[model samples]
Target: MSAVYDTRRQSIALSIVVPIFNEEEALPALAERLRPILDGCGEPYEVLAVDDGSTDRTPRLLEDLRTAWDQLRIVTLRRNSGHQAALTAGLHRSRGAYVISIDADLQDPPEVIPDMLTLARADGLDIVYGIRVDRSTDTGFKRRTAAVYYWLMRRLAGSFVPAQAGDFRLLSRPVVETLKTLPDQQQIYRLLIPSLGFPSGRITYQRAERVAGTTKYPVHKMVLLAFDSITSFSAAPLRLATAMGAFSLVVCLAFLVWALTVYATGRTLPGWTSLIITVLFFGAVQLFCLGMLGEYVARIYTAVQARPTYGVARDTDEEQQ
Candidate 1:
């Protein structure tokens, strides 16, 4: 941290943080759209591009872009941490009166920066989320899964968590500073931002497709993110597991009563199918409860380890050349 950032460097009025991972194909196009928008914003701004150990041409492309774009800065991680960790690193490193986190794929447009800033100032808001009103570019499966994800998050985390909001949002200095102080190793901005309980505004946009390259957030990563979001924010899963266990007990007791009544009537039902079905049903319920409990335990295990979310291998700001 000491080597990368000069303590004497002046802070800007606004900072836009983009986490990059194997986004080589998208860098040039992202710059093309991003630079003008930042320049037009009327306030001093810097773009902190966090390179999460991209193995492609992304690092070189960033270096080349920085040579031309003075406001662009690079923070390279030692390894490829997940999307949230990269974002956490950028947010922690960024120094600005207001910080906005956007994606490198350009799906979350840069054109909304001015609007976010304006709304934040005009309405005296601490946070402004760039919500997507339309996502017709997404595939049907994606749309369905996303809807379910947001629904589950809201149900489990309470109504405070805003739906249809990604990491594309603006946070005031105080909010950003406060987030930095939180001890959680997993940083899910969607839940984290709304939980701040700040006066907030929203600017809706139609979500666009990637300008270039493949999507970094594949299905597996999405599952992990969903799991992290649930485990980090709410205890509803644990409660649900408990409820299921109780219901299973009730069902088992009812079955026992029925079996005893039939035997007492001297008409014993030879019910191997019923026994098999009952065994399977109870087994499934027990396994489901165990899996839910395991999710929480895994989170607790990670927390007790107290490992840093990410580490920097090198930073462009430190380079003298």
Candidate 2:
């Protein structure tokens, strides 16, 4: 499974796309662990470090590392366009037969690359998902929320959406091209790729802790990611909203029946508590439905704009010329 790659080959066999934000603390260690694995593989590869408008020393560190390692390519974005956009940029730019997207945080082990490559080639798989078998390294809250997320996604996006699979995965050329063709304004590759119904395989790995730097994905970002995942992949959320509205209507009807009974029996209360509660409940239900509709509407609006998700400020490969 471990073979020497021919550097003289004109075509690149593999491309490792790493989405970096402020990963200055992790870059060196990432290269240390990642380069050896790539070098040992029997395919000529390039590591694409996408700088998502880092406000820290991440860009400078990437440049320094690239200076020493020619295989390291830097794709600097004009602004921080978020994780998914950074990934979209790298996937579009990567010119390899197979591309693997990973994070610079070193949580998803680089040691699994050869195995992923071997499995994909052996089985002729278009996608190889790196599933986290043990998430004990993650906080309890993180793990629980992640479990719920996968559960909802699988139920909504279909059971084919693998549980515990994040963005760490290998995509063959065909899969990469197919992803490129998608017109999604906000791409959630986790669901988007699996929905393609491509022949795929999964490799389980123990999830590790971040090597350095604060986590870019806080609670808010996780919520947003979940929102995007639900909206972009399935119309289930909208359906859920409709169901809630129907339930609210039923409740309102029941309340109306009760009020009529009270009025006919001459036992109607003068207190405003019941009226205020009813108003608040109905208002809350309406707002919830509207929010769900707004999410889809916002996506439609962005799609109509047809704006690029990310802009490349600089490319080391081009700069070399």
lDDT of each: 0.88, 0.90
1-321: candidate 2 lDDT, tens digit per residue: 112223332489999999999888998899999998998996678889999999998888887887778788889999999999999999998988999999999999999999999999999999999999999999999999999999999988899999999999999999999888888456898988888989999999999999988899999999989988888888998898899988998999999899999999999899599889989998998999999999889888999999988889998777655
- For candidate 2, what is the TM-score? 0.94
Model 2: residues >4 Å from true position, as ranges? Answer: 1-9
lDDT of 1 at 107: 87
- Candidate 2 yields a Cα-based lDDT of 0.90
> What's the residue-level lDDT of 98 in candidate 2?
92
| Model 1 stretches with alpha carbons more than 4 Å out | 1-8
Q: Give the lDDT of residue 5 in candidate 1.
A: 31
lDDT of 1 by residue, 59-130 (tens): 999989988877788999999998899999899888889999999888889888899999999999999998
Residue 272 lDDT, candidate 1, scale 0-100? 99
The RMSD of every model to the true structure, in order and in angstroms, is: 3.0, 3.0
